[model samples]
Target chain A: MNERYSRQTLFPAIGEEGQKKIRKKHVLIIGAGALGSGNAEVMTRAGIGKLTIVDRDYVEESNLQRQQLYTEEDVFEKMPKAAVAEKRLRAINSETDIAAVITDATPDRLEELVQTVDLIIDSTDNFETRMAINDISQKYQIPWIYGACVGSYGMSLTIIPGMTPCLHCLLKKIPIQGMTCDTGGIIAPAVQMVIAHQTAEALKILVEDWDAIRTTFTSFDLWGNQYTNIKIAKAKDDGCLSCGEARTYPFLQNENLMKTTVLCGRDTVQVRPPAKQQLDLARLSEQMQASGYQIKGNPYLISVEMKPQRIVVFNDGRALIHGTKDLSQAKAIYNRLLG
Target chain B: MNKLLFFAHLKDEAGAETLSIDVSGKTIAELKTIVSEQHGLTKIDSVMTAINEEFAEDDDIIQQGDTIAFIPPVSGG
Candidate 1:
């Protein structure tokens, strides 16, 4: 264990006994963005024995402002966020075993990843991923803490599978396209405060101090001087799609997912569905005919051609929508029409 | 009459942590217009309306003594 945790261990609640337990626990943190960086740093320093850091995106200059793990050199190298965080965390505390996985958390990947860790901590930027994690945690009966931030505010909640209400219990349904740091612009302090709370709750859980973990969802704003705690002790609602019926709606199972690539200098879009789903070739060709599109390829991989718009669909329900710079809008379109 | 509790940015915009609005046999949409008239919320896209801590749909009816809230999009970890 790291000597840096000695001061924290001195506390009666987390004495040597608790420190030992903490050192044996393995925590998995998803998302190596702002919140994940702070969380990984704190947990590693606090001497959590094993750490698994996962993130898909690489570090960029914009991330240095609040993502405490990466440096200018890392941004220059264009290293993945999880890899950068693992390198920094190893320097911070070699006693903690740090492993980095650079990949997106789709439903297929989650089943493999969730089984390896004792707990899950959310640092995802979007609601879809967060809800996915929430569902996975509840299904596996594993504890996961949800954390998020934007502007000068942050929020956190400790979800202990069977004990407290999960994320769906607190918010009846997903909000209608909430704003993000990319849109709203977040500050550094707000990220830190929420990460601090998550790390604290994580510590309590790691130390096996179930009594010390917070039961309510907490929110605060650094610039606004506001603090509020929403109680979520209620049982999972029967109406909730995920937690209510214990249904594990795997996101990867959705046929709308597409694997696409943009042509070197061409603009187009492509979409494909699984082999079992009828493609309605006549109907699809009719819709594309008006747009001057040519349908090509066999049933395995359908290639659609239009004036400047191009799209490709595979048998496994993969797609590539071209001519658009925004990925969210593309995914939304896929979900709307194909899902 | 109903009590409306605000959290995060909604609380900041309202300038008060908590307040009340009187509405009898009114739908949430109608009450929103009344509240907007007083609070000058001519543009209402950013905030989400909830009743008793649960999100309320636009057509959901609002009765007296119900707890109403306007929640701004929040960010926290």
Candidate 2:
């Protein structure tokens, strides 16, 4: 046994025997953003047997702020997150077999990936994607850990097939949280907090420590100084489309094709502020320049290139994000560059 | 006095995360009407509720001194 894992193996819960089990399980991680990056890094270092990460978005300098696995170099090259994750994880633990898939986590794509993995980790930044993952998890009976964070708030829950209430049951009404990292902003600490909970549960699951896994949906607001372990067993519904007897697997259906954005197909996403208003492009341009960003613009609009995406801001406060169709990610790029 | 907890954007709208309000017999839905008007939280109908740390439904009755928490979904990596 390599001394690299001696400390972990020495732990009573994850002894040498537990370490061996951990080293043999396959894990699939969706999205390679803050949560995904954190989960992958921890699991890779833990010497998981295999990890397959799928991410479609390219790295931006903005990501470097919290996405620990990325650096300025990755942003400069406009590398997709999955590809970059694989490179970094391999360097951290060569013993771990790392595979990266640089494509959208579509329902079909997820079904194929879930077939070979023992567990899934939900690190997506969109509701559609999470639903797709959840349905696939139920259809295949694979356990997955859910994690998300924005600003100083975060949440996580472990879903074991046939044991825990699935994400489908809990989201019958879909808590359409209007804030995204791009809109609400985020903190590194919040991301880490969720990661801590998720990875801890992942370890327990991998070691088959069934009794130790959390049964509650954990949530918190670090800045607000609040923590909660909400009882979610009651949220489990036998009539749930994903986990219910019918097992319709709605998310896996063709109509539920996980489109990155509601207004996708066009590479450019037009973002308008909450209340329609006029935008002073000149002042904003000056602000950008003052903030050390180079810009190109006319009186009507300002076009700024934030690597991997070009944002063109019109005078009416609407901006066109070219190069990606992910609405939340587009907003994030716009906010990071403009604000 | 019922201790109310807000989460995610609700916490932001609340200005304060926890509050003490008198909701002796209001149900979760009825309480939402009151809090939404006060905090300017729109479209909060989908938020989950936990009464005394246990999940509660829309019609679940709220008694005095119960600690209720409103948890909204978070979607960021």
Candidate 3:
């Protein structure tokens, strides 16, 4: 009876058997932002045997608001999020084996990552990357929990390969339009709420309480006081371009989506997703101004200057942003642009 | 007359658990218009809807007992 897990093992459902199951399990966690950081701390403390944390960004001063692993020193050092999180996780629970992957979680890399882990957890901020993870989860038959938060709102969903409808099953269409935390401003409490639910679901899966897991999508807005879940037992549609037809629309891997580049020295990145869709630039410009960014545009591209950053958007909704070197930061820019 | 279901943010935006409408339409497209007007949503073109638990096509006809659901572009995991 190790003192580290005595409290958790005391629960009848977990007891000693559940403690052993956790010690032998390996979990993969992508993204080390708000949700990722909090989940890492919670899962590690719960005695998860191995935690593989993958993140592409370095710590920034702004991350301290909700990113649970880093401090001002870590941010000033420009330490990669996975690196810093790994260091801190060991201190929190030295008995657990924690590995930090300091690279972008791309499709090619995903195959290797998924092959070794029993479960995957997504804390990513963008739709494209989440879709990629969803495809990999289905292909590997491993379950994953997706969690996200912004403002006073958050959402969480569990995906269990063949047993449940995949991410695409629920969201047939991706609105390339919506607000992001960076644009809308996020509160830390919302991030904690989302991570708490995601961590609890992971615990259920890890402890082998499959029957108690959530199959439907769950979302809540603490400040706004809204929460709900949608039933998805409906049969998979044949026309679904993803899970239904098993069509792997691996977004960024395809030329159909734009590409992103992180510029050296300038702390900016550029994304070049195919601009096949038309947009209302006039209305978008108006919205940008209303959201506090100064907007300037002609026909080819619209530039939004939001202090310390300059976002150049194209007619097809593609954008080249000059600010923040992290992939999540660039993705956040695109999320705001699309929104 | 049938019940229209909503999910996630759309359900939140709707502010109601479910909405009931009394209208006889033999097709899904007509039902989309009815739900959109009742929900005050932008339009039915960008939104996706299901008829009797299946993704409905523009020409797909709706039966009397089928349950219709309005699914907005999903942002969930």
Candidate 4:
């Protein structure tokens, strides 16, 4: 309607009609890291009616190389990624309603979020969450694009329910413990490659351009100059636990996920209390200050600086222990600080 | 003989992006074992395989002169 999307509307594939369709769509982006930030920015600027972004971590210096939504000030203030994304996206386009959630994207939370959204985008850093999203995508019959990157490699697949093979069908036979950015390192271009494919697919789906949606799963190695798109629509299996004839949706259950786990390539471990609790940040900050702990915080979370380790506590009884991937050490630190 | 290709970390593990190997008549599973041993791709057992750009099923046979690629999934933001 406004001049905001005139350039996009001029594109032959997505004319004024497509732009109007996109304006009526709502997208749910899981994980507010690099992929999440990129997707959120494009969707907002493209004039998507609504965007709900979910992320648990905060901005760190290491993230600046690729994650474009955050700034040095966010890292200094220890602002959560979702909080900063919400602040930044609102400033970018005030018309688009943005809901940035600062919490873990557990299966239960994902199902709740998916109920009101038209599409889901996978920008997460772990298979656990991806599998959950996949199962949810299958269960709800919603379309979602899967994107991942590590080192100089990136890949994407668009999964449409009842039309294409789901992620579970694609990788059902393979053992999934593989490389992460922390182990193999990554480049900014790799992240961008995934964003490009994912954004294109998102736009096509939002505009109801079903014919243009890629039927193949795309993978590439920019450093090696290698690329391929596999036609796996025939790979769909009737026995898939997530999308098959006997659908079990194993990942939808809560037991499959853990309360404490190491973050992907972050050198960090996250710990969540067994039962959710409403933590008072002001009271916690006061108590920490009284105890001589160097504290910095906002209304949503608090940060306590420790030697060689920093603890970030959120209102939902979760803490991210930075500077270590040792699960036990992180749990011990969480107990000591938030107990 | 068959043409073998590797992607992502698989290329590094295999020491080359493409390799021409003599596997006159071998199933995809048998070929996987051979390549995994030859290239020391420890995760080959779990990695997904593609034959000529189509996902190879367990029973798919590798015909002579066919192209194969081993793809390992990466999960990092």
Candidate 5:
């Protein structure tokens, strides 16, 4: 054991034996945003053996405020979040084998990745991805820690396949809707709090300390100074779909999946076509130019600049419409141009 | 008077963290209506309520001195 983890080993709960267990555990973190960065740092420092970070987006100036692993240099270089995070984590602890995959997490990809890891961490910003992760976790019977933060409030829950209620069960009562961080605004303290809770639970799971894992739904508002732990032990029953006896994985079924999502902290909305289609950027740029829209094109993406809005379309039929947060407005532009 | 607490965006919408109201015997649904009317919030029904740190349903009664918190759904990383 390296002296780097001496302090953590001193803690009786994680004494030497727990440290060894942590070094042998493999963790898969879904998002490389604020919560994901914080969780990755903690786990890496604690000597987690291996970690894989997956993210679709690149680092931006706004991300520096809350995302700990990123710096202004990363934004200037247009560095992908997962790659930069992996670099930083490896620097912190070279003993930990860290890998970064820069791509959107689809159900098929997650199903394959979840099999290789002991635990999954939910740091994704959207409910769609979270639900998919829940389905994957339940299907593989792997435990995962769920964490989310917006403004000065945050919440976390640990989902153990057979022992506790899954996220679907909790969502049945408190359906997550409306008021994203882009609209609501977030602070760093709330992000830290949620990640702390998630990291603690992750360590417990890695050490197989089932007794210390919290089964309740915990939420807190730092600005308001209030904390609550709702009893969710009885929330999951035989009737529940994800973790129940029937085991119907609706989120993974590819039905009613959203085509557009408003990106957090960016005045941008992402539109992904339901079915994958290859786009020709040069031809799209030529069409946009002929249509009286100012256009710029690279091999990978085509950018169309209109008055007050810019649409950046990628080759995979995914477009990020800047200068708008409204889903309808973004979809309308995408449909009119791309369809 | 029941002490009502607002959190996250709800606090920003209400413009205060705590609001004291004389709704001792009122149900959570009635209290939501009162708070909505007073604060000009349209989606009061979407917010979750907690009385004295325990999750409370819309039909739960609000007693005197109970700290009622209205929490909006937060889905950010």
Candidate 6:
């Protein structure tokens, strides 16, 4: 065992033998936001073998409040979250192989990554991505931990495929008027509390301690001073569309995926055109420049400043339309500018 | 009295985390209507019902001292 992990190895539950298991495990974290960054730091320090951190956003000044892995320099440089996270995580534990993927978590991308990872951690801020993670977990028979927090409340669930109830069995659909971090706001303590539970679950799974894993849906409100652990082991619906006997995997299906989404807490909307369309950033930049739009970009992305709203387009036919969260208005901008 | 609990944004909508209502033999649907009227929540239908930490259907009967939680969807990470 590495001298750095000596303290962890001293722990009885993850003594030398269990530490060996953790040293050989691979974890794929979906988002690089608050929960994702926190989980990455904890898991990396715990000596996980390989970590793949994926995110589609860049570091912002506001992110410094709760996202611990980033610094003011990263925000000033407008660094892509995955890359900065990978750099920080590598410095934390060089022995762990870290891969920073800069792209959205579409079903096809998740399918390819799931084949290589042992487990997944859900730290995304949208229901669409959570549904996708649930589908991938069920279809591949891999285990996943779902964690979310907003305001002073946090909730989490562990889905072990056939053994426990998946997220769908818990909440059939996202409430139409559900509040997001953007609308409702969030506290740093809540994010820390949720990630603490998630990282502990991740460690148990990596150490192959199935018995120690939590089987209930756990939630707590710090300000309200309330905690609830609802038994969700029996909530597994045999007729569930995602994890049922037939295993429809509707979220993984191409038709069910959204092409555009209003990002939470950012007042931005993301537009993902069909996968078949490969965007030519150079050509788009030339056209935008000709139209008097100030454009700046590298090979991966191009940003166009159009007065109040700025549009950043990626190579994979995805655009982040800033200054608005209306899906219809974003779609209209994408159609007029990119199409 | 049935103890009704609200979590996340549901707490914001209800203006309280918990409330005690003097109703017995009322189904989850009937309870939702009464609670919505009392709390002035327009989206009561979207809140999921759980009886004593177990998810219950709209038709599930609410008995005295039963703890019901109205949970709205949470999507923050």
- Provide backbone clash counts, one per model: 20, 1, 6, 0, 0, 1
Q: Please list the C-alpha lDDT of all candidates, in the order they appear.
A: 0.70, 0.83, 0.74, 0.84, 0.81, 0.82
Encode model 3's per-residue lDDT on A172-243: one tens digit a residue: 544565446655567888888888889889998999888888876666677757665655566355555556
Strongest candidate by TM-score: 2
**Tens digit of per-residue lDDT, candidate 2, span B1-77:** 99998887687678887899899798999999999898766656767789998888788899989999998876777
Instruction: Report the C-alpha displacement of residue A285, candidate 2, in angstroms.
Output: 20
The pairs that clash in candidate 5 are none
Question: What is the per-residue lDDT of model 5 for residues A270-332, given as tens digits with 9 covering 90 to 100?
Answer: 988655656656755764675567888899998888657899988887899999998856764
Query: What TM-score does prediction 6 earn?
Result: 0.81
**Candidate 3 pairs with clashing backbones:** A177-A338, A177-A339, A178-A339, A258-A272, A258-A273, A259-A272
Instruction: Candidate 6: give the clashing pairs.
Output: A182-A265
Residue-wise C-alpha lDDT for candidate 2, range A1-339, written one tens digit per residue: 679999899899999999999999999999899999999999999989999998888898878889999999999999989999999999999999999998777788897888879889998887667888888889898999999888899999899999999988886744442456765678999999999999999999999999998999899989888889998888888889999888898877775442223345677877664434456677667656654566899999998876678888878756788888777677556544433
Please name the candidate that would achieve the greatest DockQ relative to the true structure: 2
Those runs of model 4 whose alpha carbons end farther than 4 Å from true positions after fitting are A173-175, A259-339
Query: What are the TM-scores, per candidate, against the unseen true structure?
Result: 0.74, 0.83, 0.82, 0.82, 0.77, 0.81
Ten contiguous residues with the weakest lDDT in model 4 chain A: A173-182
Ranking 1 against 6 by DockQ, winner: 6
lDDT of 6 at A29: 99
iRMSD value for model 6 = 3.8
> Per-residue lDDT for A174 in model 1?
46
Q: In terms of TM-score, how similar is model 4 to the real structure? A: 0.82
Model 4 clash pairs are: none
Correct interface contacts retained, every candidate: 0.26, 0.77, 0.04, 0.78, 0.58, 0.69
Looking at candidate 5, what is the lDDT of residue B57?
Answer: 67
Q: Docking category for candidate 2?
A: medium
Per-residue CA lDDT of candidate 1, range B6-67, in tens?
66655645677678767757887887777677764433444556666555656778877888
